[model samples]
Target: MQNPATTAFVSDFAELPATASHGPLRIEYRWVNEAAGNAPIAVFLHEGLGSVAMWRDWPQALCERLGMRGLVYSRPGYGLSTPREHAVKWPVDFMTAQARDILPALFGVLDIDMQARKRMWVIGHSDGGSIALLYAALHPDALAGAVVIAPHIFVEDLSVESIAQTKALYETTDLRSKLSRYHSDVDSAFYGWNDIWLNAAFREWRIVDELAAIKQALLAVQGHDDNYGTMAQIDTIGERVPHAQLVKLDACGHSPHRDAPDALNEAIAAFISRQRR
Candidate 1:
């Protein structure tokens, strides 16, 4: 699949912008649509191995469609964000790091106190989807809603297998070279993510149980023919979370947004519009 163009979405010249205090490193981000005049702000979290640049223009399209502001950036070790220790792998509580530390830091830098400011929407894909759920669980009162695409609630054999294949490609093919354009510390970002998921400890990891704490309206989407995760991930979200909905697209893969943007965006826009009411 072709990576999207998101460098254009970043604020060309900004200072001390958003900061995610994940470990010793702080993430830098570009907050979009700050002047949209009360529109919803969508915080976009990228997939594993995905940086802001890799997400391309999807945030732009979603923000435009939802009449919302947007925030997009690389995590620590991704894109222009600061890199972290090579030996210090993402802890078992990596998602927790994102939910408790990173999300709040981003909001702080953007001067958005979710308690006082307009509640925002979250659009997350793959690993981002899991992070979105964690954010919702952490800040149920602050979210307007969430759209999680191809999320993993629990680890799966296929998920690991797919990551292995991707690792092979990254080593043998031009995958790393391609990802390099998107991430300033591409190796750190890639190995940090890859090693964690492939770790034996991560196989039993599951967030579906913890996500029941979330009160925000939820929309979980997955492709039936997904190469990584199955539609059961979305089903798990719907079963465990209150006011949750699911959409299983046929002939779709792990990346429904890239594989079926029109259908994906249409479903997302509709879902977001309904949540506002």
Candidate 2:
């Protein structure tokens, strides 16, 4: 199988004007298995501090396993994409805006027509997972399915604690320097996510009600050892979207794709196969 990570260095760019007055955002993205014409597309949304480089070869591996093409991108303020302004603070509804506005515009810019949209599948992790859920909710008919790993449907004390700790690490530890390798503006990626997540108002952030709007095949996966969120996250998803499937992996941390790649891939592959049937 061709390694997608090798091609990540040569990313494509698109300029999407901010919905607010924040100016145009230069989005950095890459396509995997584009040669696999007519195959379904799997859009991979990265974690809060993740860039396309951070995904390594997981997207390529998964695409090869499923015989699908893949799209992976660094959202604004991440990777080589336009960095977030230092003075600006992300609103509590930031993820929602990404789902409702940014993603659709990206699809348009990339010429992901109606036919392609119908065959689109989203596989998102962490913050990306939340965005995927919101996107699926906003356009229930647009996506074929979605697999969210360690998604946040509502705020939790554990989540806040872990985020606060991460912020401390970013400030004091070499985490910033390490992360800088992946992002052009490392602070833009780190603080943009950390600040909003630790905000007092962010504690009230919840998407449980909004999730009820999603009608597509949905799978929520989380790790047993995930420190960022608890099982309640996926449990709430199952409650709101009764048809949504849930998977829990033992001995795994916040990132199931990294901690349990084989298991995660098998679970997602099975879910997609069932959806096709």
Among all candidates shown, the one with the greatest TM-score: 2
- TM-scores, in order shown? 0.90, 0.95
Colliding residue pairs in candidate 2: none
lDDT of each: 0.79, 0.90
Q: Can you list the residue pairs that collide in candidate 1? A: 4-56, 5-56
Badly placed stretches (over 4 Å) of model 1 are: 1-24, 33-35, 115-118
User: Across residues 18-86, which tens digit of lDDT does each residue of candidate 2 receive?
Assistant: 566357889889988777778999999999999888898899889998889999999989988888998
Tens digit per residue, CA lDDT, model 1, 50-115: 877777777777788778888886777777677656887887678877877777766776678765
Compared with the true structure, model 1 gives a TM-score of 0.90
